[model samples]
Target chain A: MRYELYYWPTIQGRGEYVRLALEEAEADYIDVARCRNGESKMMAMMNSRRLDTPPFAPPFLKTNKQIIAQVANILFYLGARHNLAPKPEAARLWVHQLQLTIADFVVEIHDTHHPLGSGLYYEDQKPAAKRRSEEFWDSRVPKFIGYFEGLIGHNKGHYVTGRRLTYVDLSLLQIVEGLRYAFPKRMKRFERKAPAIITLHDRVAARPNIRAYLESDRRIPFNEDGIFRHYSALDE
Target chain B: MRYELYYWPTIQGRGEYVRLALEEAEADYIDVARCRNGESKMMAMMNSRRLDTPPFAPPFLKTNKQIIAQVANILFYLGARHNLAPKPEAARLWVHQLQLTIADFVVEIHDTHHPLGSGLYYEDQKPAAKRRSEEFWDSRVPKFIGYFEGLIGHNKGHYVTGRRLTYVDLSLLQIVEGLRYAFPKRMKRFERKAPAIITLHDRVAARPNIRAYLESDRRIPFNEDGIFRHYSALDE
Candidate 1:
């Protein structure tokens, strides 16, 4: 079945996680918000009071009479259907757990530039952002990314969950790429401690389907409007 | 099967969500961290390198040789086994989607008190916390909580998913209670706009199992250390 993905057209944001899975699986899908009049359609569906299972936010996948929302939840659905996750229930839950941890990390990474509140401009919260960013790199980043590094070392495999590439690995690729773009100088130093994560990131990036998708125009460039933004002040 | 839940000893943090589900299901489980010598065991399990699937953090359930982390993931597992979720794949996904939304709301609420970073104490980030709390009460709270309110109104049932009480309903109860504890002044006014959510909260609270759990020592009191902390400064 062809899937319809609803998200902001301008930036990868959380939608990129879903996009990576669909691309990796070679699934037929449409990036709805990128299509002409698609944003309006997405808003209409979101605002539609008639929808029984209305999504709380975007990055929802619509297919077969169901609208699934939340990045991890969407990935969970796609992973089960597309052979991106393991067959065993226990192993599948483990991968989803890692994805949820990635979700938490994403929030922390975004807060580095918008600590005071998302409603406020980064310019308005620059001082607070700097302070938060300092804490993020000093404590949060290592705590989170290091956990994955340890997992990779322990698993002794190219992927997070053994040799198979699950959606978690796809997300880790996005995390590495996003961090590098958002905090080039800091990520340069951080990369030294997480060679395994970097290696996995490179592997996922070089995957034929993922490589094609990354180079395609459908892949939205990372921008300040997205979760991972390049701001020199916050980076340093 | 007896489930062993690993989480922090203090505070009704994320662990409480899992605790609620177990209570509602009347499932046999041990709050590992709360038991004697349990905290050390929890930390050992977390820091163990030999374990193939180590949890990034606590509030994980170990049962039938599977360790499930992430509150939504654990609830998804328990919901299926305990009849707390629907039978259909689409319906079950809808319930899980709502639980994931609740997870996001929890992060926002936690950040209202610790916006700069969780590493820094509330005392250190008081001004930033005030600014973040203002935006949270003004924009975030309404957007997240109101979505659930709207869903309840649209569902026109006793629960968020209609007719049957799902884990989402239990989480909504926790959100209402936590918000009331954390931001009494703001929530007093906010609750007026979310009467349906408040109603669902009360209904869930009045359930025999949940009420018993809330009254028992198993339910940790909301405190300064947990996700929902009452600081008069942040509340206003």
Candidate 2:
């Protein structure tokens, strides 16, 4: 298993979902393109013509044969490999749907600070962000999180996939952590309303492999370049 | 063998993906929550979704006891049921990853006009949307379309999966049509650089079932409420 992941090295952005899955599965993979003098290698993967199906963007996972992109779809592919997804077709899709929901939520999270465009700086879009964030806080965030809360209520277990620890669970765990990191004051106000989600995050963090991974040096600390950036103006 | 789709009546929206598959497969199904006095029926479905797994929004499909939401997931789940997707695990994952990429691209299309928040009216966000459309035209649109061009260039045939008119093929066709509808001048410019993708779109639309669907009354026209809406301000 070649298992190469291409993503920005320094920030735990969307790419972190891919990283968490590989770590929890105990897969033999390297964050190969993130080392010293490795930016070109990452660019080369982006430029690779040998790949039959190249990824639209990273973080893409390449085994010797298959290259899968999109965090949810990567997990879907990897879930089959590592038994992180449920087997029956219906069960599998429920998991996939949950992951897509997470991606949608992540988009809203990013939009809270960059509603105008990704190409422009935050300062340039601050007014737009402020308006978007207010709407996001009042409506979108609770709806998205509440949807997850509903999933937990339905699943009859701590995980999204009903008694199974799937990648969506881990990713949700990360989202909760990232949200708290990004919006500490807001998250505190809603903690009681989203107890199941908070508990799920706590449970995922305490998992043996995940606990060790978070405690270890392998986990990249969240920073400004990532999705969950700290903007004091938007946080409130 | 039972399929029930939940979606809005007045708009095709993302629900069309599920509709196309069910039509092509000649499957036993009902477009539930869409009937005489459909608004009431739709609300009834939403109310009964007192379950945690209730769809975050409509365009959800139910097969027997299993409910699936998200356009891509529905296609994915149905692709296997109807043999539309590749059987090989890697190939299946590859197709799924492509679908999610298209999903991301679709959201970007919606954001072109609804850049601030989906909750806000288009008129309210028009100023910000003008800026959003500019970035999408100048940067994001070409990058996404270019990425697809690269993927098709990798394979022998025009389709993303090669020799198979998979859901991605249908989706790319819809996307091409949508982008063309939503951003004609920009896409006209984009088309000059992406002939292969344009050809793939042609092939997908030219498929026997797809052609019929395109000509049929069931194929709803793109409207202001749908993903592809024409606003002169959004166009270059």
Candidate 3:
């Protein structure tokens, strides 16, 4: 069965987390909003009064009768369905818990460029953004990366959940990629402290499906429009 | 089984979400950080290198061998065991999806006062905080509350998932209370547009166990610190 994924057509944003998992599982899915006139369909679904649980925003997945939103929630559903999550109940919760932490980090990354709100332009919040990015690079990035590094070290296996390439690993790969793009110099310096996470990123990147997706047109380029924006002044 | 919850001693913060669920279920649990020498215990656990799955921060629940963190993860675990979540898997996921959205909103609430980063003081970021909070009060708050209002309208039952008092409902109660305390005048005016959410909050607050918790010392008072903060300048 083909799944329907609804999100903004251009940027990967939060939708990338779900896309990476689907690609890894080799699942049949259509990125609905990217198709011609597909965004209108997505909007109709979002604005539909008849639907019982309307999504607050895009990046919702339509499978059978259910429409699941939130990046972590979608990944959690896909993980269980595709065996991308752990088998044990406690382990499954742990995977979801890791994804939630990643979600929080993503928000902070987004706020580095848009500290005020998403509705405002990056130019409007550049002053606050500058201060925010400084703190992010100096403190937040290392804290988060160090936490993940600690996790990898604790696990007996290569991945977050010991030998399993769970959805959390896929999301972690995205985090590393996004950080490298947004703060290359900072990440270069920070990499030495987080060798485990860095190794995990390299490992995930080498996976055949992930490698193909990274090189293919399916992967969206990082831009100022997306969450991990590369503002030279802010990066410094 | 007695669950030990590790969180900040003073503020309700993110821990409050978990606290509400435990209180509602009338589960045997201790707010670990609030007990004598509890903050030291919490810090030690956070910095512990022994555990395979060490939590990144507090608001983690220790039940026997399992250490669960993240508000939604903790709630999901408790909900399943105590029958606070919906019976069906799909409904359970829907409740989780809603809670994640609320979690996003909470991040925004926290950022309103500390626009630069959590490392900085609210007073230090007052200028940016003023601008950020104005946008939150005017736009973000309405957008989130309005989305929930639409959900209540779309659903057949009174609660988020209908008929059952899920963990999402308890969190919603905390949201309303926190928002009311933080932005009294604005919430008073905003309440007219979100009658359904207001009603839901009232209903959750009136629950036997929840009512008792709110009236007792178990419920911490809202203060200058925490996710929702009241600043006269920011409010105006």
Candidate 4:
């Protein structure tokens, strides 16, 4: 069945994680919010009381009459359905744990630009953002990258878990791309300690379906409006 | 089988979420870090490569050789094992989605006092925290509580799902308690808009196991060291 993926139309935000998983599996799905009048539909669905499971925000997936939100939760559902995750319950939980950790990293990245509030502008919080970004690069980025690097080392596999490509690998690719786009100089310095992570990112990019999606119009460009905004002042 | 939970020994931080779930289920588990010499064991396990899946942070659960991390991921596992979650896949995913949303709110709460960085002191980021906390109370608290309020209205359930207490309900209770402790004035003002959510919190607290646990010595007192820190300036 074709899936309906709801999210903001323009930004390769958290919604992009769900996109990568679906694209990798070559699954039939509509980028619902990207289509004409889709934003209105998304807003309506989010505000509607008719749905038993109303989403708090965008990047929700509608499949089989069930609406699932949260990037990791959506990926968890699609991963199982599309064979993107391991079969065993334990392994799937591990992959999901990785996804949750990645989710934490993503939130931290977003806060670098919007430290004051998501409701506020970057210009309004420039000072705080600068300070926050300093700490982000100084500690958080390395800590997270090092953790993933450790995971790769522990697995002794081509991917995070093993040879097979799990949804976490796809997310890792997104994180690398987003970071490189948002903090090019910082990532260049940080990449030194994450050779395995970089390799994993490249390997995921080389996958046929992912490559096609990246090159095709399906992929959205990184911009200021997205989670990983490129703000020169915020980056050291 | 008995479970081993590794987390920070002192604070009722993220670990409390896992603890609440275990307590509600009356599951056989050890708060590994709280036990004698448990902190050392937790640290060794965190640094050890012997385990197939090493956790990046605490609040991890070990059972039958599988180490699961991330508060939501661990709860998802335990919810299924202990029959704490709904039976159907769609319902369970919905429960997880709710938990992820709660996790986001918890992060926001943590940042209210530590917006600059986790490594930095709340005092170092006091000004930023004031700004962040303002936005939190002004927009986020209302948005989140209202969302849960709407969920309750939609489900027409005593709990988040319907007539049954799930892990999400236990977490909601924690959020209420934490928020009340962190932002007493703000929560007092905000409670007017969230009657349903407040009622749900009360119901969860009134649960036999949870009531016992909260009154027992096992429930750690809320303090500045935890995620929901009490700062008078942040509340206003």
Candidate 5:
């Protein structure tokens, strides 16, 4: 069955994560929020109580009678769509653990601006953003990257899922690239010390599906409107 | 085998979600965080490199060598461990979607205080917290509760695992009760309107193991340090 991905039309935002997975899995899916009058359709879908479950926000997904949301949760759902996650009980949980890390990283990226409140405008909270950015890079960013690098060191594979590429690996590639775009100098300091993670990021970027998606108009550029905003104040 | 849960010594915080599931399931587990000289062990457990994957933060679960983190991810893992989620592909994905919605709601709860950044003191950021709390109750709180209430309405039983009591039901129960404690005024306005959700909360709390857990000092009281903190300024 084809999947219907509901998200904001212009900015990649969280929807981009779902989009990458669908494209990689070679699934037939429609970007429901991107087509003609799609945003209105998303509003209508949000109001509909047709399923046993519903998502609280966009970047939600649908197939058959089921609907799901949250980027990492979406990826875990889609991992079964492809053979991306390992099958044993222990292995599957690892995939999930990695995805959750990505989610934490994503929240930190968003908080770079809206440190005061997601509802408030970025311009209204630039000073607080500066301080939040400082705290994030000093404490959070290194710890997260170091953890992933250590995981790669322990796992003995290029991808988070060992011999195969998994949803977590793809998202990690996105996160590292996003950070590089958003924090060039800080990343330069990080990349060498964490070679395994950098290698993983580079390998995922070179994949055919990801490369195609990145080059095509399907991928949106990073903007102040989305999660990975390039606020110079956030970077060291 | 026993499951060991590692989180801060106090504050139901995120650990409460895991604690609720273990209690409701009557599983063998230890809250390893509260013992004498516990911080070092908690720190070491958190920093352990044995994970096939690494967690970015706490509220992680470990059994043998496997570890899982992120509140929603932990529940999803435990759902499988204790058969708390539906086994069918469609049902499992849908449950995960619901958990993600809860994650968003949790973020809203935390933002009521950290509106200006987690690094700053609540006293230092009370002004921004006021605006954030107002926006939360006015926009997000209703929007999220409305979504979950609609989801419960779509299903038949008190729980989302059809007739079975899934971890999502227990967690939602926590959200409902926590909100009542934290946002009595706003919740009073909305709670009666969502009967199924309210019933679900009561059902989970009424479970024998969970009821016992709540009555014991082991189930920490709601405090400013946790997600569902109450401050007069944050209320209408």
Candidate 6:
């Protein structure tokens, strides 16, 4: 079945996680918001009274059966269907748990640049942002990345779970890429301590489908409007 | 089989969501961190190298076979086994979706008083907290609460997912109670607009098991350290 993905057209944001999963699975899908009049269509679906399971926000995948939102939830569904996740229930839950941790990390990363409030402009919270960014780069990044590094080391696998590439690996790739783009100097230093994550990121990037997708126009460029932004002040 | 829950000993925080579900189901469990020397046990298990699937943080459930972390993930597992969720896959996914949304809302609610960084004390970020709290009460709360309100309106059921009381209902109860404790004045006015949520909160609180749980000492009192803190300045 062809899937319809609803998200902001301009930036990867959380939607990129879902996009990576879909692309890796070679699933037929449409990036709804990126198409002409697609943003309005996406909003209409969200605002529609007819939907029983209305999504709270975008990056929802509309399948033939139902609409799935939340990047982890969508990935959970796609993982089961596309063999991106393990067959065992316990293993799937574990992968999903890791994905959820990544979700938490994403929030922290996003807040580094908008600590005061997402509603406020980064310019309005520059000082606060700098402070938050400092804390983020110092403690939060290592804590999260170190946890993953340990997991990878213990798993004795090419990927997070095992030799197989789950959606969690896809998300890790996004995290590393986003971090590098948003904070190149800091990420360069940080990368030395997270060799497994870097290896996984490179591995995922080398996958033919993912490689093609990354080069494709469908992959929205990272920008200030997205979760991961390149602000020199915030980065340093 | 008895479940072993691992979380911080002092605060309700994310663990409360899991506790509510276990209570509602009348499931046999141990709050591992709350018992004698339990906190150290919890930490040791988390830092253990023997475990293949290590949780990134607390509020994890150690069942007979495997451990499940992430509040939403644990709830998803327990919800299925205990009938706290629907039988159908699509319906179950919808409930899980709502739970993930609640998880997101929880982060925002927690950040209202700790916007800069979780590591930094609220006193250190008081001004930023005030600014963030303003944005939270003004837009974030309304947007989140209003989404649930509309869902309740359309569902025309006693609970979030129709006639049956699901884990989402339990979480909504926690949200309302936390909001009332954290921002009494703001919630007092805000409650007028979210009649359904308030009603659902009361209904869940009145449930025999949940009522018992809330009244028990096992239910930790909301404090300054928890996610929902009643800081007078942050509240107003």
* Among all candidates shown, the one with the greatest lDDT: 6
**For model 3, what fraction of the real interface contacts is kept?**
0.92
Residue range A99-179, candidate 1, lDDT tens digits:
999999999988998988889999999999999999999999999999999999998988988899999999999999999
lDDT of 5 by residue, B1-236 (tens): 99988899879888888899898888899888798877788887667767456567788888777777788877877787787888886777678777777887788789788866676789987877887788787778777777767766676766755688888888888898789888888888887787878888888888888889999998899988898888866767
Docking class of 5: medium
TM-score of chain B, candidates 1 onward in order? 0.98, 0.94, 0.98, 0.98, 0.94, 0.99
- Provide candidate 4's TM-score on chain A: 0.98
After superposition, the stretches of candidate 6 with alpha carbons farther than 4 Å from their true spots are none
TM-score of the first chain in candidate 3 relative to the native first chain = 0.98
The sequence of per-residue lDDT tens digits that candidate 4 reaches over residues B79-178 is 9988789878988999999999999999998888998999898878888999888899888988988888988998898988898889999999999999
DockQ of each: 0.91, 0.71, 0.88, 0.89, 0.61, 0.91
Q: Which whole-number lDDT from 0 to 100 does residue A163 have in model 1?
A: 93
Residue range with the least summed lDDT across 10 consecutive positions in model 1 chain B: B227-236
True contacts kept of each: 0.93, 0.83, 0.92, 0.97, 0.78, 0.88
A20-138: candidate 6 lDDT, tens digit per residue: 99999999999998889999999899899998999999989999999999999999999999989998899989999999999999999999988888899999999999999999988
In the range A1-236, model 4's lDDT, one tens digit per residue, is 88999989999999999999999999999998889999999999987879888889989999877989999999999899898999788889999998999999999999999888899988899999999999999999989999989889988899998889999999999999999999998899888989999999999999999999999998999999999999888767
Looking at model 6, residue B7 earns an lDDT score of: 92
lDDT of all predictions: 0.92, 0.83, 0.90, 0.91, 0.80, 0.93
Model 6 lDDT tens row, B1-236: 89999999999999999999999999999999899999999999988998999888999999999999999999999999999999898988899999999999999998888888988998899999999999998899999999999999999999987899999999999999899899899999999999999889999999999999999999999999999999999876
Give TM-scores for every candidate, taking all chains together and pairing residue i with residue i.
Answer: 0.99, 0.94, 0.98, 0.98, 0.91, 0.99
Model 1 chain A is weakest, by summed lDDT over 10 consecutive residues, at A87-96
Considering only N, C-alpha and C atoms within 3 Å, which residue pairs clash in candidate 1?
none
Instruction: Summarize candidate 3's per-residue lDDT along B82-125 as a digit string, tens digits.
Output: 98997688888888889999999999999889989989998899
Query: What is the overall TM-score of model 3 with all chains considered together?
Result: 0.98
Off by over 4 Å in 2: B49-52
